[model samples]
Target chain A: MEKMPKWADVILIPAISILLAAIISGLVLLATGKDPLNALAIMFDGAVGSSRAWGYTLYYATNFIFTGLAVAVAFHARMFNIGGEGQALLGGVGVAVACLYIPWPHWTLALLGAIVLSGIFGAFWAAIPAFLQAKRGSHIVITTIMFNFIAYSLINHLLVNVMKPAGVMEPATASFPEAAHLPNFHDILGLVGIDFAMDAPANIAFFVALLACWFLWALIWRTRIGYQIRQFGESESAARYAGVSPTKIIMISMILSGMFAGMMSINNVMGEAERLVLNSAEGAGFIGIAVALMGRNHPVGIVLAAILFGFLYQGGTQLSIQAQIPKEMVVVIQSLVILFTGALDHMVRSPVERIFLALRRKEA
Target chain B: MDFLLLLDTSVLGTTIRMATPLLLACLAGLFSERAGIFDIGLEGKMLLSAFLAAAVAYTSGNVWIGLLAGIAGSLMLSGIHGLASITFRGNQLISGVAINFFASGITVVAAQSWFGQGGRTPQISGAARFDPIIWPGALTRIRDLLQANLSTKIYSQIISGHAIIVYIALLAVPLAWWILYRTRFGLRLRAVGENPAAVDTAGISVIRLRFGAIMIAGVLCGIAGAYMSTALQAGFVREMSAGRGYIALAALIFAKWRPWQALGATLLFGYLQALALRPDIIEKAIGVKVQVQLLDALPYILTVVILAGFVGKAIPPRAGGEPYVKER
Candidate 1:
């Protein structure tokens, strides 16, 4: 077996995978009787043609970043935590409870409280499955999938019965206090006299997401515990031989993963919607899986992959409105990306490695 | 008498209706998992089949055609899974996940573009949908033969007047049991799941066997999806399968990968679903306002408990979720 160069492994493989995904997505567009080239133009124009589009793209990216980091952190420990959806939903509940119940004097204070509560709530939801996996040998993937449904039902009940204010028919919490509202991108840019989109939901939470990426990078690569997690993921027996407890690594990594997933509510629930609503996660948790896979589980890679998906989401919305193309086209594209990058990786890798090997032999 | 009244024909009938898809899907999962492949994409295959089935049934006005189309659609997805997991030797779970997302997205995209009814097909009727098969004078004959009573009526109704697919689903259990436990193919299938290396050494192609199992699961899921759209409902709705695929997976686990037990588990889950639909009856009987959400979440909760070993342990196939790699 020939080993490919590092650059080929990191950059070349993903580039080819994306090209493959794009080709399939174009074929899908053609099958639907839409012009593939025209659809591409529409997506490009919608995603980055204007500052407002950038605003929406970055806002969506913020959610993906948090969830992506959550998944990447767990992936480092070889745990597939598919419960990010449920964890994020519970995090929204946490944000809602904190914002609606607590009379914070300022947005900064409120944001801090929301962050802590959301993280704790998300971690709490993940802890059960993690405990089951760590102590009882339950499959984390199945347990996490089950937890997602349970969280949905739980949130539905809470929004309908417990949180709905009197006289409101909607299944959502009442608006947060005015002070609890975080400053949007427009307001933040106004501090430096830069004009920006006023209606865009991009807010201070986007910066928080970036900060989370840095935090995760340090936690996963720099810390001693991170080494243990990586070791455990590589081989459980080897980790056990090296005096690293598999149980501890699984619990810590999962809890951290849940915390990141939960913190996503700060961007969507607090900064964007200003109230807790049903289905607030809106498939971002699943999108995180694609992001982590395409990015190869690196913090920087996750940020870039998240932005790409964020573009797809925002652009897909535009295409739906303008060209009558279903927004689900984005989902098809995302699935193709996941398939090519995560599942059929070797389909591209083996060929690419062979090419690299031939190139090296010719040079020699 | 009160207890008997609570367990009336209506309740039992709904239970069977709800359990039909579940039973089919559980059997599908059983076949795949028993062959060492974890197919979390059952929901996706079922969803895609449901959409294709409804769309074709409405257009051609033939339920059987729709059923065939649904099966073909599911097999297509199963082929993709095989390409990724068996041929490419990729992560089986990731392949399943991708297939699920692909099905979910493609179904809605196609439905919305083709029918333009907010991701649903036109309501199918007449011969396009499977109508209930009522045995002539079944109710009267049972009453006359056994003396008129509620119990006899319940028994008669439970035994007759369901969609033909329901009977097929019921018969499939015994068939699946015989195929799994009584045949050489079944032995090879089970053996491959347990230890592919051993199977490989014994001159069997592990890849071919796994692909066979995946295809079988695909066909079963197709029937289940067709039953949902063509037999149970009039047409397709977006995400109509909902989480039934996951619930079926749970039922498969609860049954510990056995055929007869899969039937019992699915029936129990279907009963819970039926009871949830009639919360008023539950409230009256139990004298407590049982939250419907609790009922909706019960299967998941119970599966978690079972997975945690609070109940009898569920040990999966040793080689499940792993792509077999032949040593060079």
Candidate 2:
């Protein structure tokens, strides 16, 4: 029996949790000798006061959406794929290789090829840990954490020794060919006769992120494999008894998760930077965990959560620039949100459930 | 001769110094995990304490006060974890992740506000930091030390000069073993991790035991953080824990959660880190250019291999990662 209505479970609890997080963030600001109200006003203005702000906000959102879906998919199988950071790093390598090495006639074809290679690269990274977990009983959490470090080291080696263009001091690859350039929001919006910020990195990749969210929704709710994955998540022994292969579910879910995380490079690496840079993932992989948790692991919820985080990211930059407040203040807020929604959920949940139960009793 | 030089006292000293934090953090993990609580937030706790320790030590000019401040900071974070995971029966892993993010962010934010040195405390020196302790007669010329014997050289070079915390970390291993095996509290703690329901039926308070374990972890992590900032580096740098907490976790698994084995595993990892720091020696010895990243990634890779059972199985506590429910 559900102790709370669906609406309350889906909306009310998250709202309250976010409110608590905000309150705590305010306290942190005050403790640091900053005015909470002034900070909030600045953040609000920088996040949504202008169309250009929306452009930056949406660009950041696009990255979070892809990574969040990656986390959400693995989470459906009750697997914690924290290596989204590492997987996305490898995905950037894939995008770099495809765009830099392949001579593409047009941007559209290059995009397709980059997507495929990135997915392959990300899935390949994820598969090893999945295999270890399936066959050797290694904990996925620990293995994935290790893989993140390995991926970082690999990327560092490649950037410094292998990938840097000749005579370039920075440890990043040369720019991709102009033919592979992705149309930014300015160009994409111009196609429909809509004026947009010229310099904002938001691009067609945003639509691709939306498409992924929709596709994941269908995959999780409309496909047989999704059912099997969720079943395995619910009870491994029960799923085994129902003739579902635990190994198959673990492998498929993790690969799909990796693919989504890898594809995130499309937005950040190809669309925004137009080159592969070190630490290009920019902590979005970890943000995806917070997104997935806050979104309740649902597609629509993830999109909403991703945008909220995007606002935080954009606003945080503005805060650092304009108010002289360190940008990591946003990280403190994000952590509190994760704590309230993900870890201390019952602290809010049980009390809400009791209130609902009492209301029902009063009605009776 | 080159290979023999690799085993010299200076290298051994470096290895011991490098392994101190790992040993402390690994034992911290041991206490927490043994009591049915899986703590991935050791990194955050250590980072927070490292920052606070240095900050306080700089202000107060007392290393002991800084150590206490560090412990207090770690304890505060541990309390939050206990509230989320133990009292509220929430997800332990998520709580850990949150604590890590919180520590990483708050330290930088606070450091910028207080010191304004781009997320680092002022470089501490003299009275504010833990200086290396040199034993009597060890500082004398090698020629005067017992006819310059290798044993005398080893004693003077390898064992005599280290921060006092290094000795504490080494002593902690035997102390951990004794507390975990010889004491009644240790038996109950292990039992709770294996079967919390059984422990509950035996009239032991599972919540209190888990909280006790977590508190102990906080104290050890506090010391580890202090060692890093005040003893090892002389100040706190942003993200200075530098994944040692994770490496310590890997060491915990590599040791199969045993105290003595943990010492061996941490020393091995420490040796690898020391080797990575001296790439010139490695390149000269092997006649090959070995990337430092390779050695940096070796411990994680080795842990993965161990976890995969190629080396041996690393089975965690039977009831680890679960919030004990009276009903379930």
Alpha-carbon lDDT, every model: 0.90, 0.91
> Per-model i-RMS in Å?
1.2, 1.3
Write one digit per residue (lDDT tens) for candidate 1, span A1-52: 5388788888899999999999999998898899989988988998899889
Number of clashing residue pairs in every model?
A: 0, 0
**Tens digits of lDDT, candidate 2, A4-79:** 8999999999999999999998998898898989988988898888878888999999989989999999999999
How much is B65 displaced in model 1, in angstroms? 0.4
Clashing pairs in 1: none
What's the CA error at residue B57 for candidate 1, in Å? 0.8
The ten-residue window of minimal lDDT in model 1 chain A covers: A1-10
How well is each residue in B218-328 modelled by candidate 2, as lDDT tens digits? Answer: 999999999999998989998898778888987898899999999999998888777777877777777787788787787677778776875377789999999998974
Those runs of model 2 whose alpha carbons end farther than 4 Å from true positions after fitting are B139-149, B309-311
Error of 1 at A37 (Å): 1.4
Evaluate model 1 with DockQ and give the value.
Answer: 0.73
Off by over 4 Å in 1: B1-6, B140-148, B309-311
Fraction of true A-B contacts recovered by candidate 1: 0.76
Q: Which ten residues in a row have the lowest lDDT in candidate 1 chain B?
A: B1-10
